[model samples]
Target: MATKPEFLLIGPGGVGCIAAFTINYNHTANVSIVVRRDYETVRKHGYHIDSVDYGKVDGWKPENVFASVEEASKSGIKFDYIAVSTKNLQDIVPVEELIAPVVSAHSVVVLVQNGFGIEKPLFAKFPQNIVLSGVSHIGSHNRNGHIHQMQSDHLVISAFENPNVDADSQVAAANRFIEMYSNNINKCVYFASAKWYRYRKLVYNACLNTTCALTGVDTGRLEAAGGLEAIAIPAMKEVIRVAKADGVELPDDVINVVCHADDGDYFEPSMRVDVKKGNPIELEAILGNLLDTARKLKVETPILDLLFKLLTVVQFRLKEANGYVGVPEKRPIPDTFFK
Candidate 1:
């Protein structure tokens, strides 16, 4: 009999918890999660998941839980897949560095995070391994070891295009993941063009996600303050234009689709939640990378440029206040300047 495939997921947050649950529940693989901060809580009591697709469950956990990737690496079992569901804050620490300790020669790295151009560094670091982009469309929130997954888990999995890896190998790796992840309870489909999906998601992420963080409000509040029309729509349009310049033609009604996708629900974007909690946002991965692509294609994105500039300051302040190393030493403004 063939041995069960070993799957290790990092960051047992909303997406990670769901991924671990579905894979383990379906008996598809032997699942493990690398947790930090919440390790003790989760290891002691397990995870409490209230999922829309899987129904409510209490004290649920993966087959194995490690304190960190380094700890997981020391377990003597090589992982076939390493799925990362953490925030893609590349500015603070590269994602490649975090997972490198546990990545095996045959391991396929699966990214279940949001951001444009997030796979470049990972591609550079793990040239031989397949990097699958799992674009998740799920409304979920997690606090401590408890998770509330409201929306259905519809993950679009695709292999990031890599020159170093052959197309057949990449597709096979992605299809294997789709086979392992998909079951009667959830949907995990293979997408041929992951870049198109990433661009589509940016219509909302680049606009509402950044603007809400800047205004320090939820989507409804931002809409009420006229920011939806004044800031978000224009930025979203700019994203469409940039996507076009990058050769991905989005539908004409995409802006409207993104605007009303949530149906006026009161929700905070992940970036806004990060700002509120004093956590570093994925500014570089989300906005900076897209803007870089736009610049290369000579696409004009005035609104996004403005948002990026403003958020750069926000990110700087958060890093400084949080005492992140490499932040410049503080210096008071000169009193003589006022004179």
Candidate 2:
């Protein structure tokens, strides 16, 4: 009997939860998940996902479930592919830090996460390792431990095109993920320019995620309240401008794609859910970093500037309220942060 290809996914958030389930549901690999604190419940009750297109799934279990990276590393298991799908809240614990324990020279590391400039740090750390970038369009969240898949499209992933990237390992990891994720419930595709795709995803993420989170509203609320035209579209245009400055020729029509893709008008993005739950949001990776790049490139982003300011205050208050020491930002919430 032959052994199945090993896959390790860290961070059981929206994309992580679905990716883990999809791998198991598709029989893709001997999938092992590294969830932060939901082991006992998930192991006993399994993961319950209420997928809109796929219907309800009760307690779908993976091949193996581990709590931390050290556990998997200590076991002397070598994974063919290792993916990090956690929030890009590296200030809490970098995506690299968690996966470093289990990563080997031959392992393919997929940063299935949000934000721009995220994959650079890992690529610098392990040049020999095959590094891939991934972005998800799935509208879902694991509220109270069960995943709620509200909406979705194909997950976009791509491998390193640089000459230095290990050809064999990198190609195999990218194709393998595509093969596994092309199931009835969902689809995953590969593109030549992942960096370009990252910037495109950022249009929705930076605009909608931040706007929705700060306003404490979903897409529907933004539309209902007429904030979409007032705030969301402007913020998205700024992202497009910044992307062009970075040499990525993104189309202006993408702004319309985001505006129309506001499925059901009530879909809550991951960042919005994080803010509502009082969990620390990815302020730096998602918003500030992009703003920083725009500044460096001398790109004018007045709209993004204001969004960054408001979202930072939201982050500060949410962290303080939750009693979690989050990544420091420019502003501090006043004593009367809540009226």
**Each model's TM-score, in the order given?**
0.93, 0.84
Single out the weakest 10-residue window by summed lDDT for candidate 2: 160-169
lDDT of each: 0.90, 0.81
Best model number under lDDT:
1
Q: Per the 3 Å backbone cut-off, how many clashing residue pairs does candidate 1 have?
A: 0
- lDDT by residue for model 2 over 201-295, one digit each (tens)? 88988999988888889998898899999999888888988998999988858988888886665788779988877888988788887888999
Can you write out model 1's per-residue Cα lDDT over 116-232, one digit (the tens) per residue? 899999888888888999999877778988899999999999888888989999999999999999999788999998799899999999999999999999898988999999999
Each candidate: how many clashes?
0, 1
The collision pairs in model 2 are 220-265
Best by TM-score: 1
The TM-score between candidate 1 and the true structure equals 0.93
